[model samples]
Target: MSSVDVTTVGRGPGLVVLPGATRRARHYGAMATALSEMYTVHVVERRGRGRSPAQDSSYCLDAEISDALEVLTETGSKQIFGHSYGGLIALHVALRTDLDRVIAYEPGVSIGNTMPRSWMPRYEQLLAEGKDARAMVHFLHTCEFMPGGALVTAMVWAMQRFAAEGRATRELLPTVVRELHEIYALDSDGSRYGAITAPVLLLGGGRSPAYIKQMLPLLVDVIPNAKLVVTPEFDHNAPDLGHPAAVADLIRA
Candidate 1:
């Protein structure tokens, strides 16, 4: 496994930020800049992206959490912010470590039974057949569940941009494909996260689609000391741009 490269800025308490799947720490540049005003922001560069090393292909979620722990231990920071898959990693970290507080933005696909068990396998097949964009479509569809309107058009536009930019073929591809099975294989008993005692801030976009919309309540039920923040006018990318200030408020809160 590769070690995460942490960039420190500002003063006060320490706050480590973990990005979602397929995105890099720089993707959180705006939030990092905002958070840097009050806290020492350590933007974690997860394996296979940024300055981190390439993933071993046999890696699992536990390994990813270990990496975050290593960053926390080295940085001596107890506060963490995880977005999407990173949120899931943060949730698992909270269960294992003694963090002061954690902010998780939409963790699980199975949290609301929105993803089918066979999805990952089909994605794997598509990848093997060199249908990388098709595979991406499947994953995106699962998250967005596009409706027949502007949302659908937006989804299409995003997918086109993603493909044109070779987003799926980036440094995170191999690891994303290999570890997806690990995510799919996780048992949906919900009891696994019941042990987490850290205060969690659950942030979800009101316009993020039905599947992600469904994740909010499910997460509230699973986490003991958690508060939900629903950004009504935003979607997944809301954290990136549409509502950076709002997201910063949540991080700083």
Candidate 2:
């Protein structure tokens, strides 16, 4: 049985939903609720967050893959809907298991040197200094998630320290660096993904980072049975926050 804390809702064939870095299972409540009408939704809290245990010193891509597979095995989930880093995990799982379908939303797959790294130094330094809020701003700014100028970022960071969710999110801030590093560690050209046998849908946002959107079609070209769809209505955080119901519609399609 997987030690992972999976939020189960609805009933029918299962669809495991893997959250992105800096995300807990509950972050998927809305999406899971929407998909619940059609399928049993298992929103898994990847190891290191919620009730799940942390990854050991030897943790790597295999560790994440193992955690995800355990949930799949325990849930008998034949389909998966992975967002952000979770999308990256789903693609890896597709290589190991014959899933019914794989829906990846802005998957964090780093083909060659495409994944951005210029902000790592500052973000990691800020984290090392115990300055998580600053690190978040840097991440958001660099990843194009939070757009504005320095004054706006500074103002937002100042306000974040007062919000409950912001404070809660601070606890998972380190996981961002850790998970992104994992992405970097496993970075590769699209060659390995070509073997994924399941039918794949690469969903993207019209407003996400240029790099993220650019990776979609390339992935569609690589994954044998994959196609691309860019939802002009949503951004990178759509599945988790903005428009989860619409994202569920994509998954349902």
Candidate 3:
């Protein structure tokens, strides 16, 4: 098994965490810490970020699932929470592994043409033009399910500014793009998930995009042991860094 570093916190039964496209385990510190009060939270840093090793010559979703499985094995964790793309990974892991419970917050699973294929070229163009921040912003504008309006524009502008001021966002751009591509490549047919017997908590933010809301019902219908929870005020990032305490509460409940 591949050796991966995990950030552990709190105490009790083991709980493994997989972050989304950010891939940075530390971003979920607040949520992990809160969960730690009830369970030993093991935050796994996705490959190509934090202390985890860089991506190999070939990158595939299976590698990511393997990484999570390795961590779960190492920690003896049977419960997991996956945010965003990480949620997608967790669902797959639950199907293949012996997990008691799984929580997926907006797994980014696209059905048919849910993913905006037309934006790829413009995103790549911005990246190639040395406008990494703009590329990130453009990507967000294209994918985020929330209402774009001025709020999104402001958010994108702020993200661009933040990316310009710091190296973290810029450094993570390539990884984000790569993972997004992988997500798009995934088989969107929800039928495969019917095989997952473990109890699943299908979570979505009320403020998240309509597509995400649409996905929850599909997942719940397909996964016989699944239920849905919608946090009306939270968006896609709630479980990661937005509302850690609330998310922790859900996990604990």
TM-score of each: 0.84, 0.95, 0.90
User: What does candidate 2 score in Cα RMSD to the true structure?
Assistant: 1.4
> Which residue window of length 10 is worst by lDDT in model 2?
147-156
**Inter-residue clash pairs, candidate 1:** none
Best by lDDT: 2
- lDDT for residue 149 in candidate 2, whole number 0-100: 68
Q: Rank the candidates by TM-score, best first.
A: 2, 3, 1
* Model 2 whole-model lDDT (C-alpha atoms): 0.87
Quick one: best TM-score, which candidate?
A: 2
The lDDT for every candidate, in the order shown, is: 0.73, 0.87, 0.81
lDDT of 2 by residue, 1-253 (tens): 6878888999889999999988889989999999998999999898778788886666677777888888899989999989999999999999999899999999998887789999999999998997766788888888888865678767766666887777768878878877888889877878899999999999998988898877887889988899899988789999999999999998888
Return whichever of 1 and 3 wins on TM-score: 3
> Which residue pairs collide in model 2, if any?
none
lDDT of 1 by residue, 137-220 (tens): 676665454333446545544665567445543435556665556667674756677788999888888777776677577777
Q: How many residue pairs clash in each candidate?
A: 0, 0, 1
Q: In terms of lDDT, which candidate is stronger, 1 or 2? A: 2
lDDT of model 3 at position 3: 62
